[model samples]
Target: MSQPQGFDQRDDQSDRALRPKRLADFTGQVPVTRNLSLAIQAARQRKEQLDHVLLSGPPGLGKTTLAHIMAAEMGAEIRETAGPLIEKPGDLAGILSSLKQGAVLFIDEIHSLKRVVEEYLYSAMEDFRITIQLGEGATTQALTLTLPPFTLVGATTREGQLSAPFRSRFGIRERLDLYSPDELGRILARSATLLGVAADAPGLATIARRSRGTARYANNHLRRIRDLAQVSYGNRIDVAVANEGLAMLGVDAAGLTELDRRILGCLATHRRAVGLKTVAVTVGEDEATIEDIYEPFLIQSGYLVKTPTGRLLTVKAYQHLGLTPPEADENQQRLF
Candidate 1:
């Protein structure tokens, strides 16, 4: 995992406490909320289980929160697990067979599931049953298990890694996008109220703009700032305190963390399109972390661009890094 912006135990607890339990309470991802609301309403009216759902997005975009919200809206008990945890077909069979009628089975990082386990899930998702082979010898017998009518809510940061067959099994699919500053500001305001911290509009806005367009980061920053305010500012947050707290955390004005700048600085040094492997090695992070966590915000904020050849830093990236942009070469000028 990427070091900067990664959550810890306390942040996880805070996230759970601050997550909105109902669709109406959700702050951003308007289109996704609307689609889920319609599906939930229809499901409730028909007195049938909600269809399997696939929620895809970068981390901290509220995919897991939405899965919980969906279960809440459907009045279904939800069993949570990660894709890697269910290592064997028997493990999956046990969980599937144990769900109550109309429950929601939420799997985080669903794209990482082993292929055999994923194939084992196909039957349960389609027919509410799974076939398991008992005994691994000539005496083995096929045992088909009937499962309860439950919704499989899968959350994935790398949705493309999932097989086409697995992706198709989810009838209601939604992709969450990064939040706008205004939406993040609203979310922070609510979080402030919940956390019992007195915060000014400017303070919240400052934190929001520095949140990398993710609610989790906004709330995480709020909690940390709240700590600073409690000790030094009489439990009050203003722009100065917000900026001070964020700076202490190594978050710059553009919401770029130390790792983010390091990645950009690497690209700036190259002054050309650098492949993912090179960027990963130069930044001392794995390729997946750079691609999934850091690259999304950089690309979305117009700081970086992915080319057929490799990843290139844009003029905005150079400006953010306090460096001059280099003139493009003949073959690469078109990229600029």
Candidate 2:
């Protein structure tokens, strides 16, 4: 399914096991998890349907996992789909009508829905019904199908793209924040245990720091490192084993990937803040991807900064690249 740039793609039967099973098992977003738990309890006590939920955040922060957790916590069934898959009004209507009472209809990348389809969603969420017009000309008739009271759980990386009416229809909204390195280490440890891989704390911490504040990245690195350890060193992963394996993949000490290096190298050529388009042209990636996938981490890590004029490579970025930074203009010296 089409999603916002960089949404998690490894979601299958095998990969789904990597996700935390319940709200308690979820490792980060403490506030969000707590609030969701209370909301679920309140709804259950009242014997009412849980409010429609909106999970908005950058990709790979476990938004989909939370959607599933919501259904599990409420003891309600969940139907998973993406915005792009529901291309027509009938598609939305069919799914809505088929849902059992209090079921969760989870739609990932809700912002990608066509404007017309999105408009169709408003009534379904608000009134638990879909009004469809059948036939054309004089034979046309308006048919309103009453659906079971169901919760709509929408996940989006681009919250701004949703129309105001569509956005307001969701009764509960929560944003998932990036995980800290410490939280990521704990998650990595859990993943290693589940995968039956022998990983030490130091090794996990090393990978966590380089995980770009993402659990998916950390898990991928852990599997790769574990494979390397098994083949070359008897499956025991320590600090040395993790470092040596990751270094071979061009993941530097700061966890910057090859593309990150390329971006810094391209930006360094200008020696000044440069527009995103110029960076994309030089880096050979589209502007949308750079904005959605790359820039967030770069800015969060203090390796890059965005300003009104453009993006500037920070001193830390140059230092990580092992290059001397050029003299900065007095106006651009301070970090934003």
Candidate 3:
């Protein structure tokens, strides 16, 4: 059977096992975890539902994991849904009305919610109530339903897409940042223990350095490398084994993937600032994926820069690709 457009069977199965069940077990995003711990403690003390939370960051940086953690920490049952799935006000109402008291309603990609559906959420989030129309035209009647005092945990990769009015509804908002290699290494070490894989520090460090500063990427890379180690390396991973696995997966020492290089190559070909649409078309990726997934690491790694006009490759990118930067870019590089 074919999966849905954005669903990944591998993630569906593996993520649950690898995910940190409690906030205390989570590895990265220190600031976010810290704030959430305090909030959870306060809410528990008050014997009230936790405040609605908004978590925004690049995909695979553990927004979904954190949502589940929040639910676990609060000892609340969680109901999960995505923004695109709730297409209408009725759909939102149905999900909202079903929640038990002190439950957590996790909505992934919350910024993709429709304008009308988002508005319908205002009262539900604020007052734990919703008003719905019972009929059409002259027969229409407004019925307000009281919902359980559940905490709404919304996650988004693009927070700017949400309207100011919608954004303001959340009582708590936290933006997760990319993980440092050390943080990712710590996460990978824990994962190795859980997976029962024998891995050395250098081997895990090698994988962590190339994990694109995301714990999800680090864990995924560890799993793939573990397969290689099991079959070819006596169920043990060393630095050489990790390097071989990453090379087999087409990830470079710098952690850039084939698609990452293609995006860089596209920018290199243009030799000037290029618009996102042009890069997306050339790289065979959607604009959002490039912007949200690929571009962040590129910018963070000093391989690319975004100006008001467009994106421009840096001298580091040209060197990585074994190409020469234009003279103007060469002079600009000297300035830095």
Model 2 spans > 4 angstroms off? 1-13, 330-336
Q: 173-223, model 2: which lDDT tens digit per residue?
A: 999878899999999999889888888999999999988887777877887
lDDT of 1 by residue, 1-336 (tens): 554564545577778889988888899899999999999999999999999999998888899889999999999999999998999988998898889999999999999999999998999999998887889889999998788799999999899999999999999999999999999999999999999999999999999999999888888989999999999999999999999999998899999999999999998898888899999899888999889888899899998998888888888888888898887662354444
Report the number of the highest-lDDT candidate. Answer: 1
TM-scores for candidates 1 onward, in order: 0.97, 0.94, 0.95
lDDT of 2 at 91: 90
lDDT of 2: 0.85
Q: Candidate 1 local accuracy as lDDT? A: 0.91
Of 2 and 3, the candidate ahead on lDDT is 3
Model 2 TM-score is: 0.94
Residue pairs whose backbone atoms clash in candidate 1: none
Cα lDDT tens digits for candidate 3, 1-336: 122112245666876798888887899788888999999999999999999999999887899998998988899999999999999999998888889999999999999999999999998998889998899999999999999899999999999999999999898999988889999989999999998999999999999999888777888888889999999999998999999999998889899888889999998998888899999899777899889988888899999998876898888999999998888745343311
Off by over 4 Å in 3: 1-8, 329-336
Worst 10 residues of 1 by lDDT: 327-336
Of candidate 2, the 10-residue stretch with the lowest lDDT total is 1-10
